[model samples]
Target: MTPRATTLADVDRGALREEAERALRALVGREDAVLREDQWVAVEALVADRRRALVVQRTGWGKSAVYFVATALLRAGAGGGEPSGPTVIVSPLLALMRNQVAAAARAGIRAETINSANVTEWDAVHERVAAGEVDVLLVSPERLNNPSFRDTVLPRLAADAGLVVIDEAHCISDWGHDFRPDYRRIRTLLADLPAGIPVLATTATANARVTGDVAEQLAVRGAPVDGTDGATASALEDVLVLRGPLDRESLHLTVARLPDTSAQLAWLAHNLPRIDGSGIVYCLTVAAAQQVTEHLRASGLDVRAYTGQTDPTEREAAEADLLANRVKALVATSALGMGFDKGDLAFVVHLGAPASPIAYYQQVGRAGRATDHAEVVLLPGREDRAIWDYFASMAFPPAQEVRATLAALEAHGTLSTAALETHVSLRRNRLELMLKVLDVDGAVRRVTGGWQSTGEPWEYDAERYERVAAARAAEQESMVEYVRGETCRMAFLRRALDDPELTGPDGAAWRCGRCDVCGGASAGVAPDEAEVEAARERLAVPGVEVEPRKMWPSGMAALGVELSGRIAPGVQASSGRAVARLDGIGWGGLLRDLFAAPGGGGADLGPDGDPGPRDEGLPVPLRRPVVEVLDAWHPEPAPAGVVLVESATRPTLVRHLAEGVARHLGVPVVGVVRPVDGVPPGRHDVNSAQRLAGVARRLELDLSPAAAAGLPGRAVLLVDDRTDSGWTLTVAARLLREAGAEAVHPFVLAVG
Candidate 1:
């Protein structure tokens, strides 16, 4: 049997343009909806010319329209018979994919998604795709690298895919604002594509550098097959690059400079209702988002928290609620940034500034898409840089650590991620990211058992990584400058992206006249004294429950640790308490300062630092919160004693906090748990298994006879300065339970 042939040689250009318009009208459900010239050009390039293209346009500039229109035109053959192969789109976030699928459906295109969240439906979706019952298939980049998917399904998909789409294409470049190593797998996909297949890469944020890198990657060629020369493949120079002006005229940008988190929260609570409509409240961390959500709810505003930690169902509900204007706002982290399509979103308020202007642009762009005017505010906080620094610390592992990982992988035939962590000090996330980077570099391969070395010699590319790090540092500084009102906020961001539209005939920068700086608007927008006081009181009243670890991390025994399975409920610590997370917007500042290294100022110093003892006891404000927590706790049977975890670094601070708590509660001070066996202070910089192992070997119980005698069936409060892994409290709780304490309640000043 002969296969049917498909060709574009007979395509009628005039009819193609008409069909493109019809497709756009169907997609947007508006007869007046039409394609911009650049959009048309992109469609023509893909459908008629069969050329790869990169479209760098603003968030609402109809980038998706270009691809959807192209998909429609390509699927409807030039001669009009059976459709072509399915369009494969590599999307980043599930939210984005869900939106894309709906949009495609509007255009009468059958679209399906395969991602981590829809595991049960994967088989059905795959069957549909293979049976030619699907028009478009959206998948995450991570799925592209999955062992089974890559080994079996992907090859078939790539071979016959009509068109390839890389959404959020900036992620293909390391210098992108939100770089993901998994996106680099797209290069392999591009290389393996059969000739004449058009590929499209789309992104809302990409500087000139990232743009060039993505374009180059899109032009990469497949290896020579069966001794045939592959040098004739098209180079990236031929790739059509459509870059549009990134100015969003409807967005009225402003920065509200408040003195502290309390003032920021107060301003938000007071002014959120004044904003035009439902939108997002961007936060820098999950804890900050949760804190902001709670504060807003207390102020009678309907808001929800949206972060990576949010349950999938809850996230979908929150998104739906915001879209329907049922909630005033969603206090969210970057998890809500990309590909969320709400045409009438009226505002975006950042509780704290993002680390980079590109990131800030992407987030704020979520608003003012369909409306004539929408508010975008940035409430810059003092702790922004600290949060940036913490993230920067995870950039790329040191060269030494990378070398050690490669050595370990080479020694072992195959090792799972958990097993690899036991051999290296890097955390699970960072280690996994590093391995992905290596895999793309051809230094390693993920097999059934785990990852194995490819025995390929690879250089660390230290200079390139250093440059990327330096670029990030520069971006951070620019973000600080943005908040400082050093220039027109809109112009500053345009220049940051190297947008050509911002340059005038005389070579001076053009101001959009919509930002607070350009409009001579006041940066101080604090609410009245009473409201500010209320917010301050709310933030000051601090206490967070530290849910105990139920089950130990899997594969602990592979690390030579015997601990495994669920923690015995009888010996476990009750849900504990912390004054705040170190990254929280409220008590975070004070707690952060309290936990700062002694000699290094505010820097996070490791165990090597002195962290000199201070004479100051627990602050008066903090003391009140501790008592408030105790009053609210109402632990059954009450705590009979207080047990302190001896702090090797901040001994003075820990001792003062313990004594203060004991005195306030009128409870006896039980003997402290001391470090033993010459074990060094537990390093907070390592992985969970390693940290827990160290804590298990180092900590020892030292209960006085009187305390021991009273511990038969009494509850005790175990206090510590801070917790990163919570292993310290876990081990300490075990020790106290072994000493016959009926229940252990762990409390800490902060949790990192």
Candidate 2:
């Protein structure tokens, strides 16, 4: 490595560019490495004028290059004396940060990161930063609101920081495809910075609206406290916005519509091997990703799975395996998206459609970054819209829920998230998200223990949320149009993102001589009929192990329920089976369709058009699979009779399913148990403690005359339409045991 550049204020402009080129060469370890014109423009803004810059460029366009180069210049400007305070990068994922730290090292810039994975070393990392031994310090967005970090460390870091970089800046904008509430805290971070500390924000997936939103946010010097308006700040006028065309010339885009999950898996098993190099196969859910991974490996191909639920160490190993080309592809969800750097990734295939074009573009951008040629394929499933709707339902909570959360915080003064769950109905994840939003809006504050209200009156922005919801709907529709192939796929995406380079100076539409629509669709090497049959059989093979709840959810006692800690082995339901998971790539599609709410958003509405799991009989096709799963299942102590758990909405379906299971087992229907009168019906979406509380309230065994005759000292099968949180099964099994049943075995058609 060459010696570091010294601070030189009198250097000529041309020489400054040359110095940047030298730093880039050292960074990339290539003598020919040079900064692109746009990259240089961003660096100059940060280094020369101390101005904010948002560089919206393609993946391979060296967005990281701009920041590292700027950091080098800013540090060198301090000369042999104390270097400027470290450049603090607010990154989204540890995977991204790790890759960036490696890249920074190549440039001789010492980069250190503090993320959830490396909590033990955070104090050391903080000490290094304080000593100016770190050039760039990467921290996750969540770190900004961490009480200790925010109150103690952040103020100092903000005051002493040379430059601040927000990687994945699109997340800051509500209009962006993947918005996070934690990212909103960046405005507070920026507002706290000392004057003249240049901030740089970078992203590859922002459309025109997101770009404006992010750029305005980067210019937070004189912006409003809430930023809930169109009022222009004087600082916004000065921020530099560097946007380039998003076209990936090396990518050959294709969208193939498949009839069902079986065909989609078959196509992947067939085409993945023929796609040349290692790449990615994205699924809409964790279950789907795991299934695809299993299918690909069973087809004698190298594959692995990456999802949000994967362990941290295993995720790192999987990433390394992919980067080293040890695996042909990683079947993954959006957890693999955003800032995962694999330069030579040859292809990106989506097993299902993403809800937004920009989000899809971001995922596909993973491929063809450094390669001269790469494949980008999307096999849109028939169930894409339903899956999209399922995810869309997880958006911001209702006004009443948000207000209730704030009220709870106000009433309690300060409550840990667990304690707060008792005061409000929202699940932990959704509740934390609401608290972050409240923190960002000045309605609450995060402290050492948990969260507290600021006693500030805040009105729900129903109109803004409605507008965002409308925008999301429009994005989904545009994605559908893209799948229909009404226009060139590349052109459609470019236009959707409002790419300024969609047209030339002559005002003609830009056309890429690639993609299924632009270049005529090809009959690519197809999977054999045998492969399709195998995939179908795999989908048909049912039985997802339904592990009974081993322990009660914490805080049940706080709700006046006595349950807590480990469930008694005597009362615990034996490990059982479900025909399939509601998120699986196999029977999941059928389950989703069967259990869909009236509006097609979730598995909530019954056939009577009411909320909760649908009240429908096990369909003829699903019945066979359920029976097969039971026939194949061998419980330790055989169930003596069926004890049907009466469903709030699906009583008929539960009875019908129970009868079929009983016929298969050669057992009698001995009992039927119902919830106590006026008890709240099954609530599937609540946190575990709340769900357990509801289960305790609702469960009361009223055995029939036949049960009275046969129930004593006999094992019974607990039947239901589905299991969510498995609380109902747990509590019901306890009741059955208490009613003189020797052992309880839980059976369900699906795990939703």
Give the winner by TM-score. 1
- For model 2, state the Cα shift of residue 725 in Å: 16
Superposing every Cα of model 1 onto the true structure, what RMSD results? Answer: 9.9
Estimate, for each residue in 1-752, the C-alpha lDDT of model 1 and write its tens digit: 23433236667888888899999999999999878999999998888878889999999999999888888877876435345588999999878988898999988999998875555467889999989889899999998788999999999998878789999999999999999988989888888888778899999899899998898888887767675433344676778898888888888888887788888899988888887689999999888887788788779998887888654444666787888999999889999999999989988889888989999999999998989888888998888899899888887889899898899988877998978998899988899989999998899998887899999999999899999999999999999898888678878887788786766763355778888989844444569888889998887655876656555543456556687666788778887778777777567777777665354222233454545445366777677667777666665658899999986656677889998888988998897998995677655545456667778888999999888998989999999888766788888998898889998888888877
Q: What is the lDDT of residue 640 in candidate 2?
A: 86
Clash counts for the predictions, in order: 0, 1
Q: lDDT tens string, model 2, 1-752? A: 22322223454657778888889898899998878889888887777667888999987888999999989988987222235678999999868988999999988999998876555467788888888789999999989888999899998988888899999999999899999989999987887777778899999999999999998888776345687543257678888999898888888888877677888899988888787789999999888886787667668888878888654545676788899999999889998998899989998999989999999999999998888888888988887899888777667788988888888887779988878888778877788888888888899999988899899889999899899999999999999998888777887888788888876663245677787788744525556778888999876655766656556654455678897556788788877778788766567777777776543333334544555554567788787688778877777679989988887666778899898889888998888778899765645544556666777888888777777767778888889878766777888889888778788888887776
Clashing pairs in 1: none
The number of residue pairs in model 1 that clash at the backbone is 0
TM-score computed on alpha carbons, candidate 2: 0.73
